[model samples]
Target: MNTVATPSEVTKGKHQIDLIDGSFTASEAQDLVVPMLTKKINFHQIKRMSLFEKNHKDTCAPDRDRILELEEAKATVEDIFLQAKIEGKKVKMHSTIHITLED
Candidate 1:
């Protein structure tokens, strides 16, 4: 008794059949609670955040105040990114920029 599950069943918190002999079997199905972790993240924009934090912590050897400052900076950057997203603008990070004024 091989059965195939529909996308709706898989997505809508419905019980799914187990695979038997590479085919899903309804008779072998059991009511199961799927473990899922949902997080609000856009990896495309903030993929390097982990590395940034890791390197900063490791290299900077931050004291408590410095750590707090780092955390605040991270929050500020996130807020800027969110605001820019809402305003339909792109944000680019640059390591260094030189500006000069000619009078």
Candidate 2:
């Protein structure tokens, strides 16, 4: 089968969001994963740049660090996709985003 991604609607006061849970072919997995990672990386990059512009220095260390981490994750994901593509395998992926209210 192809990729099936069913995103659940967020309920009131819900802390967890089900983003994707499905099986996907290698190409489908790459299509689904790469864009998400790219978007997240772009977000952090923009945030970091904005902070730097505002402060005239590298003020968003956390965002910078997160961008690096996401880049590494993207690389690892690419490797997994490459292996799956070579092996003619499908990948089962489940992703959830959790929101927390912190003091």
Candidate 3:
């Protein structure tokens, strides 16, 4: 796990955090990313359910949209892993999380 960060480049009340950046084997990439995506999907699903239960009129549109987006990302990752396996090559992955104050 390699992390790259530049404190000087960050603005006040905002931060960019490097989560994962490295080359990994096919199985390793799957193990790292698939579960994360699944967890995100599950998180949105639960949030949607909670909102719906709290108010029957609530559509949970944002949560539904996010779940779809995450599912597509997971599928793309799976395809990349499959292709890497066929080619017998390692996969390069990079991810970052950004945080900022609302007000």
Candidate 4:
């Protein structure tokens, strides 16, 4: 599952987004858009490891971490577009995802 930030104003099981026309591929998002956003936001740097020392417990940690972030962002974008298309709402760039629990 993907994750995105939830706005304080929005209650549970609600979402908000701005809608716009056009679509792009995950590669485009990962390479062009995500880099820009991460740079702008100043994401944390991956720690360096020495040759003798074992770095991450997971061998694919670096790639896995980055891919996860990209996937989540992609999911958010897909969700926003899907909502706009289905609901005919004018949302773009940003949106919320809500989760519900059944009793």
lDDT of each: 0.39, 0.87, 0.93, 0.48
Q: Candidate 3, clashing residue pairs?
A: none
User: If ranked by lDDT, best first, what sequence of candidates would result?
Assistant: 3, 2, 4, 1
TM-score of each: 0.33, 0.79, 0.83, 0.32
Residues 1-103, model 4: lDDT tens digits: 5467556433455454433234544443334444554553333233223311454454555644665676677567666556656665644233243455334
lDDT (tens digit, per residue) of candidate 3 on 12-43? 57777788899999999999999999999999
TM value for model 3 = 0.83
Greater-TM-score candidate between 1 and 3:
3
Q: Which candidate has the highest TM-score of all?
A: 3
Clashes of 3: 0
List pairs with backbone clashes in candidate 2. none
Alpha-carbon lDDT of model 3: 0.93
* Top candidate, metric lDDT: 3
Model 4 quality (TM-score): 0.32
- For residues 15-99, write the lDDT of model 1, one tens digit per residue: 4333222321222111110111011122312434555576755433224344455556556655665676567664543233233
- Greater TM-score among 1 and 2 belongs to 2
lDDT of 2 by residue, 1-103 (tens): 5454345433334476678899999899999999999999999999888888889856687998899999999999999999999999999999999985555
Taking all chains together, the TM-score of candidate 2 against the true structure is 0.79
Error of 2 at 70 (Å): 0.4
Off by over 4 Å in 1: 1-62, 96-103
